[model samples]
Target chain A: MRSFVALFRKELRSYFGSPPFYFVATAFLAYAGYYFHSDLIYFITFGFGLNIMENFWQILFVDLRLVLIFAVPLLTMRLLAEERRLGTLELLLTYPLRDGAIVAAKLGACLVVVATLLAGTLVYPLLVYHVEPFAFEPLFAAYLGLLLFAGVCASYGLFISSLTDSQVLAGFLTALPLLLLWLLSWNEAAAASGTLPVVRAISLFNHFQPFSVGVIDLRDVFYFLYATGLFVWATLRVLEARQWRGRR
Target chain B: MIRSELLTKYYGSVRAVGGVSFSVGAGEVAALLGPNGAGKSTVMRLLTGYVSPTAGRALVGDVDVAERPVTARRQIGYLPEQVSLYPEFTVRRYLGFVGEVKGLARRRRRAAIGRVIEQCGLGEVADRHNGTLSKGYRQRVGLAQALLGDPAVLVLDEPTVGLDPVQAVEMRELIRTLAGCTVLLSTHNLTEASALCSRVIILSHGSLVAADTAAELGRRLEGAGRLVVRIDGPPDAVAQGLSALPGVLGIERGEPDGQAGVRFVVLASNPEPVQRRLAAMAVAAGWTLLEVQVKPPTLEDLFVRLVGSEP
Candidate 1:
């Protein structure tokens, strides 16, 4: 437990000690804030001031998904790649800690960065509540959806970071799979065909739609948890295989 | 406290470490001497559990490294070649992290960090970020990280590879202070091995060529000794007299030393006996013998003889 905490703190310090974390955070907030304001004003003038959560909340989440897809790669690219490139991974492996602890600490650090990036958007909801107090339950569900989505993306990005020592390659490979998953259900006609159940079951858009409408289905919650666990487990397996690959 | 039995490793088709076996008792300082690609680093990696051996076993203290790597690693403090470290971390924080990973308590981590910082001469750079440090300071920090938790065995590979003479000497002195633990380091510098290690293990082409103390290796590898003499006498007559002496295999005459003196290199099966004989013969011939010195073989000589001559 202590080693995990120590590793977590060290990774956190490294994330903030460099320029990349701040760069990604600033870009995420800039894009998210810009879209949030535009959508909110569009609802106020064009839709006669309906509940902000009903009109612009889902749009905010959709933009956040885009921000997450970009920001997650930046946050996770250096978790293992930088360590391997600098050759510190050898030293780290010699320490009296399990490989799982190292991976968990790094993943935890990435989630913390994602959380901080999401924290900046709390102002949008605060501004909504100040003008007209709306149903808070749906707002909570939407924020919950964004959190799970960020976590899932961060896990996949962490797995990709373990594959290479080049941060650029880790970022590119991480974004590629996420971009595909994000666009998996863009054609509704294709989604409503014979592959509807299978496509909807796997699509991030289908699972996240429930939370956007204030419906907390257990299946959707389980799907997010399942994806998070599967990727985290895959990351663990990759790290375990590294020892074999490292051997001569 | 450390042992390897028939240890071997192969990188695909290339053998990096052959069936090599050796052991270091508690509180012994040993050095692995070899050229590039000689499996020195591979052996260290095997013992540190950074890589598993292809065959045989490496034991740190009583635990086999491959069988229980985490348990065995708890007893070792390893500083790899080139001294890789996180460039963003300050020296203190880096060592603190290492201590924590080593399972030291919070209070103990603080104390260990302080002790290693003082022991490694890192007081000046304890708070400085690693990326901003000089090469020498970075090596010191690397050493400091390895010293945390006071493990029973220390494995250092080329601890002073790129430092200037002063820094190298200081680093060696720091290693010398670690006298109560089993210290095994691999280095290319013969003088460093002679200065810091009590035993030397020489490797060539991924196989153990020789292992012994520096003096013993010198004596065993050098079958014959050499002596240089400068005599103030007739050159031919001096050479003839030296040749007449017993145990002198051959004599080569060199340029005169002026004032009617000559220098001769006498190769003998035993230089000590030949040196005494030449001094006595010089006295009998009324030759003014300016110098008669035996050239003792060094570790460098043995290394060159073994590594340079290996095909």
Candidate 2:
């Protein structure tokens, strides 16, 4: 447990010590804030009388998803890929370090980065509060939605990083899968045909929809939890295989 | 303290190391000498637990590398052919990380890092990033990393391959100081083995072709017998006199001057007859036989015999 903590702190220090953390987080947060306000103003001019839940749902769908979907790949591509390219992975592996510790710390540090980005968006709710002191239940749900979405994406990115040493390849590979999921449920003809239930279930939109509304549905949370678990398990498997491959 | 029994390693149907068996005890430095692809690195990897053997067991302190890998790994410090380090990290940070991974306690880890830096001559570049250092400094840092936690055994693959002549000499001196720590380092540098190792293991085509002390290796590879004789007699007279004698194959004389003037590298079928002839000549020539010691074979002769003479 102590070794785990030591490794985690070392990982976090590496992230903070490099340029990627500060720039990536700040840029994602600023873009999300700008787009959410723009999205809100555009909806208002259309005379859309969105209540607290409706406004939160609208911000959640367009703003958070757009920024997070793009930002996640940038934040996580280097987690394992850079270690491999630079041969530091061997340095870590040759030590008394456990594979679980390495995977946990990498995912945890990315989550922390995601947490900082989510924190920056708190200004959105404060701005919304000035217009009316209505209940902000839906916005709170949206924040939870944001956390789960970021966590799930980060895990997927880490799994992809395990597959290749090139960070650019990892980013592209990760984003392409998420982009496909985002579009999976939207192909109107497939829904009409009622085929490909697997594709429909795998889509990120279908699972994230309930949270966009004022509902913290257990089912949607479970979907994100399962997504996070499956990829993290895959990440662990890949890391474990490295030892086998290295052994003559 | 270290042993490998019939250890073999394969890279997908191609055997890099055949069934090679050898052992090294504490207070001894053994050199694994081989040409390229002679399985020197493969053997080192198997012993270090960096790679599991395809068959057989490698025991470091009675911990079988394939059976109890972590324990085996903990007892050995390995420096691979390439000094693979975290380039972005300074030498100190890299060692600290290595210390933690090697399971050293915090206080002892610090002390060990400090001691290894001084021991490997890495104090000058302790704060510099490992990537930016020169080849000699980088090799020292790699050696420093290997020396961490004071592992009982060190497995260094080509530790001095990239150094300039002077640095190679210095690196050899450092390796000599590590005599108490069981070392099995492979090098093309015969001079290194000549100066440091007590027993040298020669591998050819992944087999134990020769295992002996530096001088023994020299003698065995010399075919029949050869001796370098220095006497206080005339060079031309000695060369001509020795050539006329039976079993005296050749004699190449050095420049003459005073008592130590006449010297030559001698080749003969049998060294005993040459010794007798030299003793008789010393008495008859009215000159003293100052030095009549047998010179061991040169490294080139050893390489030809051990690696194969056809090349």
**Which is the leading candidate under DockQ?**
1
Q: lDDT tens string, model 2, B131-199?
A: 899988888888888899888998888888878988888888888889579998898877777677887
Q: Write the per-residue lDDT of candidate 2 for residues A1-248, one digit (tens) a residue.
A: 55566677777777778887778877887788678777777766863666646654455455678688889998889889988886667546545556677788889988887887788877777876787666777777777887888889999999999888899999999998887667565664544455568676776677777777767988889899899989999998887664345431
Candidate 2 residue-wise lDDT at A79: 87
In the range B1-311, model 1's lDDT, one tens digit per residue, is 98989999876667888999988889999999898888899999999988888898999988999999989989999998877888878888888888988889999889899999999989988999898999999999988888899999999999989999999999999999997989999998888998999888888999998887766776774656768788998888998999899987666688754645788877676888888889899999999998777876566656655675422
For candidate 1 chain B, which ten residues in a row score worst on lDDT?
B302-311
True contacts kept of each: 0.76, 0.25
Model 1 interface CAPRI class? acceptable
Global lDDT of each candidate: 0.84, 0.77
Residue pairs with colliding backbones in model 1 are: A248-B10
Cα RMSD for candidates in order: 6.5, 7.2
Model 2, position A154: C-alpha lDDT score = 94
